[model samples]
Target: MNPVRKRRFILVSALVVGAATVIGLVLLGLRENINMFYLPSQVNSGEAPRDRSIRAGGMVLEKSWQRDELVSTFVLTDRQGSEFTVRYEGILPDLFREGQGVIVEGAIGADGVLAAREVLAKHDENYMPPELADMHLERPK
Candidate 1:
């Protein structure tokens, strides 16, 4: 090939490699920030990653909320009756209560309890949280 044509081909190849590298790095960064959402059943079935950050959503089980001086424990249940225990060490949201939709973000422990770092409560009847909505969960009748 002529010198000019060879140089053009090399430049195109370099541009393609650089673009691919940038895209790959962006995806790797995003993967670290992506917290996957799961339901109670998925947690109960051991489908959730044990040591990675994740989000779990379901209705707070009736009569299962207990608060101590520094910690709170509760059971989260889905419509299908699957349940998992959650232990949180911070102040819960004002709208949080039993029988209401809630989502907790944290990691599952070796003992099968979720150690929640954050708790979010769905306050209104008409508005559903996007994560729960994505799962198509229906509120209790």
Candidate 2:
């Protein structure tokens, strides 16, 4: 092979290899940070990874909430009857209540409990703000 052609081939090969390496590194970084969402049933069935961070959302089970000072524990359940316990060590949101929808983020333990790092309250479409609750709106016929 000619010297110039060999040099050009080497340069192109190096550029391709460098680009691949960079793309691989970026994917690996993202994989670690990605938090996947799962249903209570899925988590209970062991479909979710025990070591990775994940999100599970469902209605807060009635009479399942128990608190101990700064720590709160509750059960989340879906309509299919699958339920899981979650433990969090922070003040819950004001909107949190029994039968309300909530999403918890954290890792699942070997005992099947989710060690939550964050809790988010979810409201339905008909939910009205406290300030607007008392105000009546006139509808156009």
Candidate 3:
């Protein structure tokens, strides 16, 4: 083969390998950072992946909230009545309360508890503050 052609082929092959390596690294990083959402039933039935970052959402079980210093523990119940325990070591959202909808991002431990990294409380669109409920306002036509 010609020397010039051989050098060009080598250069092209190297570029292709380099690009592939970069893409692989990017995908690996993303895989580690990506968090998946799951419901209580899915987690209870062994459908949710264990030891991976995930987001679990459900209603906060009544009388399940326990707070001690910085750590808070609670149980999340889905529509199907399946419940999962969650432990968070940070400040919870102000709106968080028993029976409220919440989504927690964290990893499911080997013991089947969610070790929450963050907690987000969800509210309905028609929700109104109790202090403002007494004052009714007319809707725009």
Candidate 4:
């Protein structure tokens, strides 16, 4: 093979290999970023994956939101509106409210309950007023 042609070929091969390696690493790293969504019923039925981090979304069951100053309790629902009681120990999102949508991430316990370590609440752009977000607004009247 011509010397220049051989060098070019080696360069192209190295680039391809490097690109593949980067792609593989990116996908592996994405594992931490990826979250699966499920419902309370699915978790109770053992359908939700256990041990693997997952997100369970549902409406906060009316009157289900309870707390002992440390562990906050609430409920999640499915499409059919079926509800499940959820107890968690952590500071809830500002958007977390009754009848609001919420996602809990954690593992499912053998007792047919979802034991989560992290909780993420969803809200719309209207959720927080500009003043509230900027911390310059007065109390809602």
Best by TM-score: 3
Candidate 1: segments with Cα more than 4 A from true spot = 1-36, 127-141
For model 4, give the 10-residue run with minimal summed lDDT: 132-141
User: Which is the better candidate, 3 or 4, if ranked by lDDT?
Assistant: 3
lDDT assessment of candidate 3: 0.87
Cα RMSDs of all predictions? 7.5, 7.9, 8.7, 7.0
TM-score of each: 0.62, 0.64, 0.65, 0.57
Q: lDDT value for candidate 2?
A: 0.88
Candidate 1 vs 4: which has more TM-score: 1
Tell me the spans in candidate 2 whose CA falls farther than 4 Å from its real position.
Answer: 1-36, 128-141
For model 3, residues 12-130, the per-residue Cα lDDT tens digits are: 99999999999999988897346446778888998878888888889999899999999999999985779999999988889899989999999999887899999999886886886
* Model 3 ranges with Cα > 4 A deviation: 1-36, 129-141
Over 1-141, each residue of candidate 4 has an lDDT whose tens digit, in order, gives: 999999999999999999999999998998645645776777767676677777788888767777898788777876474666677888888878887888888776666456768888877556666767566444463
Q: How accurate locally is residue 121 in candidate 2, as Cα lDDT from 0 to 100?
A: 95
Candidate 1's displacement at residue 115, Å, is 0.5
Clashing pairs in 2: none
Preferred candidate (TM-score higher): 2 or 3:
3
Query: What is the per-residue lDDT of model 2 for residues 1-141, given as tens digits with 9 covering 90 to 100?
Result: 899999999999999999999999998989845644677888888877798788888999989999999899999999688999999999899999898999999998888889999999988889677667556344333
Residue 134's lDDT in candidate 4: 62
Model 1 has a clash total of 0
Q: Name the TM-score of candidate 4.
A: 0.57
lDDT of 3 at 2: 100
